[model samples]
Target: MMVRLGSSASRYVIATMAALALAACGGGGSSTPTPTPTPTPTPTSSTPVFTSPTTWSVDSGSSGVFYIATATGPAGKTLSFTITGGDDQSFFTVTSSGGLSFKSPPDFGNPQDANKDNVYVVQLTVTDGTTPVNQTVYVTVIKPDADVRVRRVGTGFNQPVYVYPVTDGSGRVYVVERTGRIKILDPKASNPAATTTLLDVSAEISTDGERGLLGFTLSPNFATDRTFYVFLTNASGAIEIRKYKTLASNNDQADTSTADVIMQIPHPRNAHYGGWIGFGADNYLYITTGDGGSPSDSDGNAQNKSSLLGKVLRIDPATDSFPNDANKDYAIPTGNPYATSGGAPEVIAYGFRNPKRASFEFATGLLIGDQGENSWEEADLLLPSDYGTAGTAPNFGWPILEGTHSFVGGDTTGLIPPILEYAHGTGGQQGSAIIGGYVYRGAVTSLQLNYYFGDAATGNVWSVPTQSIARGSTIKAENFRLRNGGFTPDVGTINNVVSFGQDNAANLYIVDADGDIFIVEKKPTA
Candidate 1:
């Protein structure tokens, strides 16, 4: 290795020796070859996410696990669910397996949510021991058919006969008592049973038979004029539709001193004084009167075209057609069937035995619940054609035909039959007295546009589809029972229903003659 040669040969020998030394030392030409860098491991899983629908619907009384939240997370990691934050988050709880449940059963009518709407909202969180993923979810509580029930909102009424809404946005209702007293009720009050007397006509009204303060309604212009009307049997046993004004000092109190008699009709008997009075869509006062009492309309008042008894009368209370007479202060509406010369100017439709209650379906339709004789009870729906001059006036075939079945005697020409007729009995759908109700235009979706009526004698409630109230059609009705919600202390079937009412919001009410005011609501339980 020390032998020397020429310069080029010496250089080659030196390089070779260096290369061999390097090889022996296990070294490369490049200064220590950089070690292959270990790559950062790729994520084994993605961020946790909700794999369930954000919106869900459950039956009103649903509790426990109605919905399940599914999520995907890291391998070998447990995905957990939780209600993080939201207006109604306190109403719900979640499990490690992602099962979402209600802490308490929900009621569609009385929502516990922050908004108090049936739609419930919550903030849902999902995590896998990492950064939490969040989502806003909504759950709706649905009202089932079995969930419709009546809950007592007011009590201690002295035989409440009718309930009228103030419609002044005050949420107050005027309850008319059979003893000639009107009281104001705040259903949401701390003590709903406590009431303030609005008016007392006990001294002026006769409470004989089906008399006394029978019906009450607010003037269409009540907000401004503060005028209201009452239907009562005066001490002399005459039907009187009187007008009164609310005290300017207090919206809840009426002027108890005096009332103006809008119209007064002499009746032969006390029992069949049709008492319901209301303003129609035409801004005219519509008065319902029964046939001069005796069984089978023995006096033939229902068939007589000139008699106002046994008829629905349309009159303009704002005008004075009978200026010379104080008993008939109102003017006949122009479109009244006999406004010109055909019949009694006030009579719009005749041949009703005793239309105890009637309400306008809208502006153009009138529904009358006429109590029957011994065979049948009936409800008649009168359209514009039946009351207006453009069409034949409705002749409900009272004495001549007792609800599509021939009974006594009358001219059979152009008779309008009852749209709904039921047998007279206290069993099943059969009922004795028919109490007319409004076409439900309330917040309850299932009851919308359905016509409701009740039986005072049988204590049964029934409803028929509005569309089924057509001529020449045989329609059936359904038993519409607003029962007690077994989950809580609730009022069961209202007995001796005197009337049905509607508030400004169109929420329907059932008036029990035994001193209770019930509101239609969702069954209060899960």
Candidate 2:
């Protein structure tokens, strides 16, 4: 601009000067504009996260070693779990690897507490690196669908074997101890404590195996007359069914003067007395008899229709005399199976090995349970319509057929089969014996309804949904068979699962051989 030269020449001179100035200022910094500062990006963190499920389900009659699946965090994470709250926490157990198991099945150890619902809350916590997470799972326990609750109500007796409960409309329960003593418990009372010595027949009753006061029942009109009956094996080894009148209302003992012999079945052997008595829906008393003790019906009395041994006898106690006066100690009902078959009039149903217990379902009038013998313990469901009817004979093949299978050197044809049959051994593991139970029909709960019956040897209470038990049906039995339905500690170990009886209100009562009585009621846990 100072030189004022021609346009092109002056422009060239100015450009040269500018280039020189940029080179002096570190390759065009001051003259071309200052360079902007470069910025650095910040890094993000790398931590893992975790989550877990919130609920689970336990099958009915499931116990011990409850395993659960969990959601874990990234590769190297750890988990810790605990049962935060529940009723019967002591009844459960947990493992380090997130496994939850019961010490015993819920209803096995202790009777479900009616006052509280059964519930369990399990909490699980997981950690990944420094990140932590937690989850809570809820578990609910329930009773088996069957209404019967077998429990050990009394203890401290020498070799206590059988227990029978006679209940009043009120919540009073009278239990018969095999030692020939009656114990009473007032369930309605504050403490529901047990009282002793209501009646003691230890002197007259035999305390040997399968003997003593094995059966007891209240008169159909027990409320008004306070009359009751007991079937006992005497010390002299005779089975007697005696009638008694209760002095104290709802008391279990006979008013000394009221000891009248209703009937007696001559028991030749110490074993196989077959002493169980109950009033049928027809109001006739039904008595069960054994095979006259020994194996293979050696006494010949079991197959003899004229004799009561190994037979179901129906009789009227209203007008019965002692000995055989054509019709004294007991009168045969016209509806007896052999009344017109040219056999003994008192024979209701024949071909039983040793019928230990018989119960009448209140709703459907069915006589069921307990056929004892060499290889099989059976449960039979007898229909009222099938009573004394031709073409309806129940064979219960004893010496001939052990269970459903025919054995060598025994009759195989024309034998009635059992509704439910099981082999017996120690605590019912191998082949031992069968203990029968009642058909539950109560108002308290609706878990196990319409099942045919319950078994004692296996400690497995089961049922068939059908109203009447048919031949060769898939009967469902329940127990804690952990691995492939094989052996387990819970097998055949149901304590106090002795006899099944009912009260005035039709509530089922379970008595233990330990002499304890437990009234079955619905105990729901959420």
Candidate 3:
């Protein structure tokens, strides 16, 4: 070290001498080393990821492979994908081609369909062989408690039990009151309301429990023929299907004077008046009749091929010939099973408890909701294989067999078992009556052409695979919640699901005994 000099010239001389001394000693003294630079990492996508639906409708069978997701990794780079989450990640996978597929089909049942287990909360990690990019996403599965809902649309009617739509290209819907009045509704109106009375038969009909104008259907040629039919319990308690034509001046108003008693069946008992009429694609009138009313079916009406009481009858009331039959009101179709069997020519199929509701599936033939006696309620899937081919339409086991279970001395031999059945008082609700509905051949994509039906007492709705019905597969149904508020109603509080109806657009509606109606709708977000 050099000491400070007193003068500037002396300080300059000392500094130059010190620098020369330090430079000569540098090779011998300790020296500091510089650090190696850290090269900046090659830039890549901030978050390279894939996309999938928020939810997916589980398929009916194991064979259907639905695309669930797709991805595109970093450009000009190879991608290696792996997903990790859920009980088994094998159910969902990401392919090297960036396509996602369902490896395992989901069954809408317990454990496999539980809320927690039904979701795949996967961490998608994609690698370009050097660095990995990660993303998290959720894909929900449809189980018994599906993501769909039933929303209330109309309320405050006089004990409305059924609502129907006329596919007559008029965009008009009719509401039938248990009080014996029919009202017209413009369904497409922003706030659809029924204000006009189309027909009133309160003076001629008796309105009571399990009785009244139970069935109504438009004639196939209603757009031109202007004819329709109403099945009702007249003041004398006789079940009648009477024909009426719309007034020429007003399509909404019918000519009461032109009411012709088409066909009337005597079901004097107060219970089990099967009152559901639907025109098949063949244009023949098909009607469902309950086993002559009583607790255990004291009279074997359903088993008897001689009576029209507990049977599905196919007749052509449009002709009004009545040439050979005893009642001579309507002509039996030549295609009926009993037409040549020396049996009641009106009987198309027999053995029903209370075939409460029936409707065609458009492409497939028929589906019937049969009310149970004590334990089970069933939805019957009828096809040409079931009816048009053989001995007769399938004989649904009623008193003979409640569901697939044997009952008190009930006949199980040669009986067609229900495709699906649940215990009545299960899941904190009771299934008192089953209201059969249409297969959802509607605009809702998630519904997947499913058959929608529900229990009247529980207000719990369910959807079965319509395709499974065609393939004769026994896939169970997924349940839909029908609540009071937008999504929540008091448990077991649907009043009474009296009947289900569908419109020309294939949209479905529910009628209740509490004088209200609800429309089944899909979730846009879900």
Q: Name the best candidate (by TM-score).
A: 1
Off-target runs (Cα >4 Å) in candidate 1 are: 1-147, 390-392, 477-489, 522-526
Per-candidate TM-scores read 0.70, 0.64, 0.68
Candidate 1 lDDT, 69-91, residue by residue in tens: 76777788888878889888888
Q: Tell me how far candidate 3 lies from the true structure as C-alpha RMSD in angstroms.
A: 29.1
* Cα displacement (Å) at residue 197, model 2: 4.1
**Model 3 misplaced regions, further than 4 Å:** 1-151, 168-170, 190-193, 323-327, 389-393, 426-430, 470-495, 522-526
Task: Name every residue pair that clashes in candidate 1.
Answer: 61-526
**Between the candidate structures 1 and 2, which one is better when assessed by lDDT?**
1
Tens digit of per-residue lDDT, candidate 3, span 57-175: 33222222233334455778766667754444556666654344455554535334324565655556666776666665554544432544555666667877677886766655688
Ranking by lDDT: 1, 3, 2
Higher-scoring candidate on lDDT, 1 or 3: 1
Name the 10 consecutive residues with the lowest summed lDDT in model 2.
1-10
Candidate number that wins on TM-score, 1 or 3: 1
Candidate 1: C-alpha RMSD after superposition: 31.1
Tell me each candidate's RMSD, in Å, in order: 31.1, 30.5, 29.1
Could you tell me the TM-score of candidate 1? Answer: 0.70
What is the lDDT, from 0 to 100, of the residue 453 in candidate 1? Answer: 81
Cα lDDT tens digits for candidate 2, 271-375: 776667778767788788887777677777766667778777778886653465521466667667666665677776666677777766542334445455655
